[model samples]
Target chain A: MLSIVAALCGLMLVATKAFTAEQIASNHHSYALKTIEHLLQQEVPATFSLTDLPYGECDNYIVNQISAAGYVGEIQYLTVWRAQQDTLSMRVVRHSETPGIGDFIDHQRSPWITQFDFESAQAFTTLDGVSGATVTSNSVRRAAIGALKTKDIYCG
Target chain B: MGEPKTKQTRTFSDGVLKRNPAWIQLLGLCPLLAVSTTVVNALGLALASTFVVVGSNVCISLLRKFILQNARLAVFVLVIASFTTIATLLLEAYAFALYMKIALFVQIIVTNCMILGRAESFASRQSVGKTFLDALGTAVGFSIALIGLGGIREILSQGTLLAGAELLFGSAAKGWTITLTDGGLWPLAGFAPGAFIVAGLLFALVKSLGRASTEQPPMQLKGES
Candidate 1:
C-alpha cells in the first residue's frame, strides 16, 4: 500500500511539474525583467539584447549569479548591474538565512536592499549594513563588490 | 467502535470556533505568524493551506480503511506533501508574485501540525463527508486568524489595508489599497516579534469572547433548599 501510494503521489507530482514548468519559467523571466527595469529606472525594451555573461545580460544590464557566504550558508542572487551607471540591484534567488533577522536582504521583506538602488560601487563601501545582521549585510556587500569587479573584467 | 454522527453544521462550527486549530488548539503557528505581514500574503498562504488541508483530508478519509495503523502517519505525510507541492506549483504558475512572497510558508504547509493533526484525529477515523466539512471549517478558522493578524499588522506597520492586493487578486485589485495613515507608525508590527505580540493580544480577545459566550445564569435545583 505504501509503495502504491508513493508511486501514485510521484506520478501526480510529475504531471504537475510538466504542466507548470513553462508557466513557472515565464513567470521567472518576467520577474527578472521587472527587476532589471527597476534597477535601470526605465522600462525594458521589447526584444532586448543579451550578452555572453555567465547568467546572461540584458542590453546594458549585466546579470551575474553571485554566491556570498551568508550567516547560515551561501546566499545566491542575480545581480543586475549597469556598467555605465555603476549602479546594481540584487534579488535573492535562494537563501537559508534566519528568517525575520537575516531575511532583510530580501527586498520584499525590508527596504534594506533599496539602499543599493542607483548607488555607485564606490558609495557601497561606506554604506551601513542592517543592525543585528552584520554577517548577512557583509555577505550582500561582498556580492555588490563582486558585481563591481565584474564590470571591470567584462566591460573593459 | 463507530462513533455517533454529528450534524454537519456542528462539526463545522466546532472546527471554526470551539475547537479552532489556531486559537484553541494552537496548531500550525509557524506559518500563521510568519507569512501574515500583509493581507495579500496572509490570503495567499491561507488559500494554499486550504487547498492542502481539504485535498489531504478527502484523500486520507477515502483511503483510511486501507492504510494500516503502523503506516497511517507515513501515508498522511505523503498525501499532505503531494497536495502542498501541487499547491506550490499552481501558485507559481498563476500567482507568481504572491507565490514568491509566501513561497517558503506555502512549502512549509506539508509540516503544518493542523493538517496532520486533522488527518490523524479526524480524517483517518471519520467519514469522508464529515472530514470534508471539518477540513473546510478548520481552514476557514485558520484563515480568519491569519487575516486578523495580517490586517492589524498591515494597518499598524504600514498604515494601509490591502496595499498590494494586486499581487494576489490580479490587476483589478490594484485599486483596492486603502491608506489609513502615512505608514511607518509601528514598524515592529511587520516583524516576528510584532507577530507574537499581536497574536497574543488577539488570542486574549478570543478567549474573552469565548468566556462571555460560555457564561450562564446559575441553575436552580428542586432539592437546593
Candidate 2:
C-alpha cells in the first residue's frame, strides 16, 4: 500500500512539473515577441523570420520586409537592418532582468526605450538611460549601439 | 496526566507564549529572512507555512500509532514533504506571480525544524486534540513573528505599510500601495544583513523577558507555607 501511494505521488509530481515548465516557457516566448513588436512597430515586415545565432557570437542578422520606411537615411536607426532592395529595421533581443527595478526598461514605462524608433545610425549609437535602472539601461543602450554599428557588416 | 482538556490547553499556551518557535526557539530562519522583505510576502509565506506545519503535525499524530519507533523520523520527513509539495502546487496554480517571487523558499519550508520538532516532540506522544491545539498555537506564534518582521522591513525599506499589495490580494489592489516619498536609508531592511539584525534583536528581547519572568518571586498564597 505504501509503495503504491508513493508511486502515485511521484507520478503526480512529474506531471505537474512538465505542465508548469511548458507554461513558463510559452509565457516567456510571448512576452519576448511582444517586446520586439513594440519596438519595431509598423516598420517590421509582416512575415519576417527569426534566426538563432551561434552561442557567444557577437553578430546576428534578421531578414525583415520593409514597406513604409525608406533606405540609406533610415538605415542608421536600424538596430537590426536587412539590405534586400528596401531597408528593414532589426533590433537585438534581450532576456532576463531584475524584477521591478531593471525590468521596467523592457516596457514603455520609460520613454527612453522609444528612442530606438526611426533614429539615425549616429543617434542610435547612444541610447539614453532610464531614471532608476542605470546599470540595466546602460547595458541595453550599449547593446543597441553595437547592433547599429555592426548592421552594415552583417545585414548589408 | 490529568484531563486531556487541561493538558491540551497548556500545550497550546506553551507554543503561543513560552515555547514560541520564532521568538523563543528561533527555528525556520530561511523563509523568515527571505520572504519578510514585504508585508504581503511575509503574510502569504506565514500562512502557507502555518498550513504545512499544522497539517503535518495532525497527520503525524494520527500515524504515530502505526509508525515504527526507529522510523519515526523518516515518517515525519515524508509527511512534512508531502504537505510542502501540496502547498507549492496550490500556490503555483492560484498565485503564479507570488509563487515565482517566493520560489525556492517555499520548498525550504520542509526543512524548517519547527515543523519536525513539533511532530517529534509534541504530536508523536500526544492525543489528537492536544496535537491540534499545539499546532494551532505554534502556527499563530510563527505568523505573528513573520508579520512583525515583514511590517518593520516594509515600513523602513519602502516607507509603506503594504508595498506590494497586488502580489497578495491580486489586481484589485493595484493602486493600494502606500508610497513614502521620503523613506530614508533602509539599507539594513532591504538587504539580507538587515533581516539577521532584526530577527536577532526580536529574539533577544523575547528571551530577556522570559528570563525576567522566570526570576521573579511568586506572591505568597493565603494558606501556603
Top candidate on lDDT is: 1
Query: Residue-wise lDDT of candidate 1 within A41-100, one digit each (tens)?
Result: 678567753333334453466776667999988887777776567677777766667777
TM-score of each: 0.83, 0.63
Residue by residue across B62-133, what tens digits does model 1's lDDT show? Answer: 999899999999999999999999999999999998887887789889889899988998999989989999
Which lDDT tens digits does candidate 2 get at residues B33-93? 8779888889888878888988889877877787778777877887788778877776766
Residue B89 local lDDT, model 1: 96
lDDT (Cα, 0-100) at B90 in candidate 2 = 66
Best-fitting candidate, scored by TM-score: 1
RMSD in Å for all candidates: 6.3, 11.3
Poorly placed runs, candidate 1 (over 4 Å)? A49-76, A80-89, A93-98, A116-156, B1-6, B182-186, B215-225
- Worst lDDT 10-window in candidate 2 chain A: A67-76
Residue B20 of model 2 has an lDDT of 78
Q: Give the per-residue Cα lDDT of candidate 2 at A106.
A: 35
